[model samples]
Target: MEITHHNKTLSLNSPVVMGILNVTPDSFSDGGQFQQQAHALEHAMQMLADGATILDVGGESTRPGAVDVTQQDEIDRVVPIIKAIRERSDCWISIDTSKAAVMRAAVEAGANIINDVRALREPGALEAAATLQVPVCIMHMQGQPRTMQSAPDYENITQEVAQFLSQRIDACIDAGIVRQNIILDPGYGFGKTLSHNYQLLAQLEAFHEFGLPILAGMSRKSMIYKMLDKTPQDILGGSIACATLAAAKGAQIIRVHDVKETADALKVVAMAVRENHELGE
Candidate 1:
C-alpha cells in the first residue's frame, strides 16, 4: 500500500522509519536537544543518513501533564526547521501537532503528513487537514494530554481504541478527507496504562480491518521505562524491540528516536518475513 501526499507517494511494501525531532524545551524524550536551528538541522540530516524515511517535527511536549504552548510559539519553533529540511531534502516530513494553524504553517513550510495525537479534534484541525490534502495520522487519546494518564480505564483496551479510531476515520471522511489519506495510531502511552499499551500492541493487527496503515510510536516512552525501571536514555534496547515487533506485526511506520538501530532491526524482520512468504509461495 502507499500513501499519496500531494506530489509524493510513500510506499508501505516495506516498513518505514520516522525519526522523532522534538523542537521543544520539554518533550518527554530528547527535549531541549534540538530546539536550536543549527542543532535541529544537523540532527535531521543525521537521521536521514541513518535511514529515516520521514522526520516527525513537533514543537509542543505532549507528555502527560504538559502544558500547551501558544499557536505562534509552536509555529515559530517548528516552521524554520521544516523549511530548512525542505531546502535540504525532499524526504517525507510529518508535522506532529494538533493545532490547525501550526498544521497549516508546517505543510506550507514543507510537511507532507499531519501526525496529530488528538486525531484532529482541535478546532479547525479537521478543516485544515482536508484543505492541506496530506496524509493524516489520527491517534486515539482517551483524554487531554495534561491529564490523560492519571486514571486510564477501559473495558477492552484494544476494542475501545479501535472503536475510537473508527469514529475519527468517519469524522475525517465527513470533513472531506480522502479515505486513503487517513492513517491510524493506537495512541501508545497516551492515557493508556502499562497493560493497556501492551494489549493494544499485541492485538495491533486487529486494526487492519479498517485497511489503513498503522503507525506505531513506542520510542523511549514510559511504556518501556516504567516496565524496565530504566531511564529514557537507557531504553534503547526496549525501544528497538518494540519497533521490531511492530514491524513484524504489520505496522507501516515505526516512529522512533534511535533511527539507525530501529532501521537495522527492521531490515532483519523484513527479510525474515519476506523469506517466509517466499517459502509459502
Candidate 2:
C-alpha cells in the first residue's frame, strides 16, 4: 500500500518508522529538550539518519491530563522546525496537531501530513486539510485526552474502531479530501484501557477492511508500561514486542520514539515475512 501526499507517494509494503519530535515542554516523554530550533532541528536530523521515513512534529503535549495549548503557540512551535527541516533534509513531516490553525500553518511550512488524534472533528479541520492538499492520518480516540482513560470501555474493540474510522473516512470524503490522501490509526493508547489497546493490536489486521493504511502509534505507550508494571522510560522491550506484532499484522506505519532500534527490528520482520510468502508451497 501507499499513501499519496503533496504529489509524492510513499510505499508501505514494510512497516515504516515515524520518529516522534515533540517541541513541547510537557510531551509525557522527551519534552523541553527539543523546544528550541537548534535543539529540535538537530534531533530531527538524528532521527532521519536513524532511518525514519516520516518525522512527526508536535508542539503541544497530548499526554493524558495535559493542558490545552493555544493555536498560535502550536504554530510558533512547529512552523520553524518544519521550515528548518525543509531547508536541511527532505524527510516527510507530519504535523501532530488537532487545531485547524496549526494544520494550516504547518502545511504552509512544508509539512506533508496532518496527524490529528481528534480525527478532524475540530471546527474547520476538514476544510483546512482539504485546502492544504496533503495526506491526513485520522486517529480514533473515544474521548478527549484528559478524560479518555477515566472509564474507557468498548463492546467490541475491532468493530468499534473500524466503525469510527469508517465514519471519519466518510466525513473526509464528504469534505473534499481525496481517498489517496488518507490513513487510519487505531489510536492505541489515546482512550483505551490496557485490554482494549492489546485487543486492537491483536486484531489490527482487521482494519484492512477499510482499505487504507494502518498506523500503529505504539512506541512506549502506557499500554506497554502498564502491562510490564513499569514506566514509559523503561518499556523499550515491550514497545519492540508490540511494534513487531503490529508489523506482522499488516500495519504500514509504526509511529515510534526509539527510532534506530525499531528500524532494525522491523527490518528483520519485513524480511522474514517476505521470505514466508516467497516459499509458498
Residue 35 alpha-carbon offset, candidate 1, angstroms: 0.7
Per-model lDDT:
0.95, 0.91
CA shift of 259, model 2, Å: 0.3
lDDT of 2 by residue, 132-230 (tens): 889999999988989988898889988988999999999999989988679999999988999999899888889998888889998888898878999
Q: Cα RMSD to native, each candidate?
A: 0.6, 1.0
| Structural similarity to truth (TM-score) of each candidate | 0.99, 0.98
By summed lDDT, which 10 consecutive residues of candidate 1 come out lowest?
A: 5-14
240 in model 2: Cα distance from truth in Å? 0.8
Residue 202 of model 2: what lDDT?
Answer: 87
In model 1, where do residues sit more than 4 Å from their true spots?
none
